[model samples]
Target: MPCDFLPAQRALLDATEHLIYTGGIHATGVDAIVRKSGIARKTLYRHYPTKEALVEAALRRRDDRWMAWFIAATSGYTDPRARLLSCFDALREWFASDGFHGCAFLNAAGEIGPATHPIRAVSRLHKRRLFEYVCTLTRETGLAQPDEIAEEFLVLIDGAISLALVFGDTHGADAAARSAQRLLRHIPVSS
Candidate 1:
């Protein structure tokens, strides 16, 4: 409840985040995270009472840091359309990294069968915020029926992630951009 984690705990959480995202929650154990982080087992347990707590912390930590990476990836884009494309590009970079798993939200959703799981709730909220942000961007772009445009982007993004994971190729990210461009063809844009 201290909000700020001590250095060792932070280190443990950071390592756990990478492990969980790269491998999985159940697949990665406390000892592995501790070893990977070079932190003591007692210290790890001191910060995280249970693996579930550690998993939650890992998810929150990853999400908190990801938005910054995403923002930077789209920072120079002059158009909202390009910003959206850049957003998926960031995802592609992540997916094609040396050790990539799939989407954290999607992964958590699969691990969590119980509706009451905190991680599941957080995943849902995270995804909802993403959709809302996409919709807001569509609105700001002066596009018609912005909500519909956002929904299309949502589908395209999800499909892209799925394909990228399915084929272990980054081309899905490029394909997703194309799919978005095609979807946007119906609406006319003013210069």
Candidate 2:
């Protein structure tokens, strides 16, 4: 069923995200977005002056959705260490889901080559925010170098996602989570 409750701009962004994820960003044009969104060309143009703008908006929406899902998935664990490992559990679920087309940020980065591209910037921001969240979890474990450990954890997370995408298997998350558990072993949990 169509989500008529969403605002027109949000509806457009959601449609664009679906199209861009299923189809390549370059392959999904404004006309396609219009047809998918069921919105008029004038309205789409008025809301987003250019395709790049629409792509950025779609990415931002994706970033919000992804983060919220991640946080919620990881929130059930009471232990800080378990919470940290839950990141991978979340990835496993996401990978096995219906629309598992790899990381949207990575896809956008590839599609928009320039480092300075607005979509690339959104992708980078999403990654940095994820790193920050990991850092928060690391700090809770009383790790001496939360920043450095968080950086390493981020690499594991991204690597797992990439591998899962490449090999068409969710075991990457398990491998990454195992590595994460080893890394957390030395650190003392805060009382």
Candidate 3:
């Protein structure tokens, strides 16, 4: 039997992720990915069965890549404050990248309207983890009200993303990072 896992299959998924994230899920059709990946239509269908499944796989891959980056970002800083700043640093880097298209989770969430949508679930989980990570960092910083700080931080990040997308500038992300750095610096180091 042929190997269940194939490099071509991975290439298709990777290509789908790039197209979907850079563009929008709805905007980039299955044919677009198949063409971009140079994979036969049959091969893609054989692996994914449907476009939605392929989209979900692409979304999952993006999430995994992002989570890996998050983990690595926190690893270099021992101080929770520095670690928290790293969050904004990462966001800034992401926003500043050449193909910078806003957040993948945000885009996918916009595409998949229903709460029950697989893409929605993936997007929700990604945002939840970011929020929870901030909360954990806030708690670690021993802030008097970590929960409140985490909430405020999340708002800042989300707002920054929106403004960035609206204005087609990375300034919003820069401002958010500055604000996060200023705000997080004040949290007491305890927990």
* Best model per TM-score: 2
Error of 2 at 63 (Å): 0.7
Residue pairs clashing, model 2 = none
lDDT of 3 by residue, 1-95 (tens): 12354788788888998998788988998889988999999989999999889888877777777877876866578987788767767766667
Q: How do the residues 1-191 of candidate 1 rate in per-residue lDDT, one tens digit apiece?
A: 24577889888888988888878777998889988999988887888888888888888777666655766766667787777667678778877887666678888878788978988987877677778878866776776788888888888877888888889989888898887778777786644
> What local distance difference test score does each model get?
0.79, 0.87, 0.81
**By summed lDDT, which 10 consecutive residues of candidate 2 come out lowest?**
1-10
Residue 136 accuracy (lDDT) in model 2: 88
Worst 10 residues of 1 by lDDT: 66-75
Model 1, global lDDT: 0.79
Query: Regarding lDDT, does 2 or 3 come out ahead?
Result: 2
Tens digits of per-residue lDDT for model 2 on 84-135? 8899999999888887889999988988878998999999999998999989
RMSD of each: 2.9, 3.0, 3.4
- In model 1, residue pairs whose N, Cα or C atoms come closer than 3 Å (at least 3 residues apart or on different chains), thus clashing, are none
List runs of model 1 lying over 4 Å from the truth.
Answer: 1-4, 188-191
Better of 1 and 2 by TM-score: 2
Tell me how far the alpha carbon of residue 179 in candidate 1 is from the true structure, in angstroms, after superposition.
Answer: 1.5
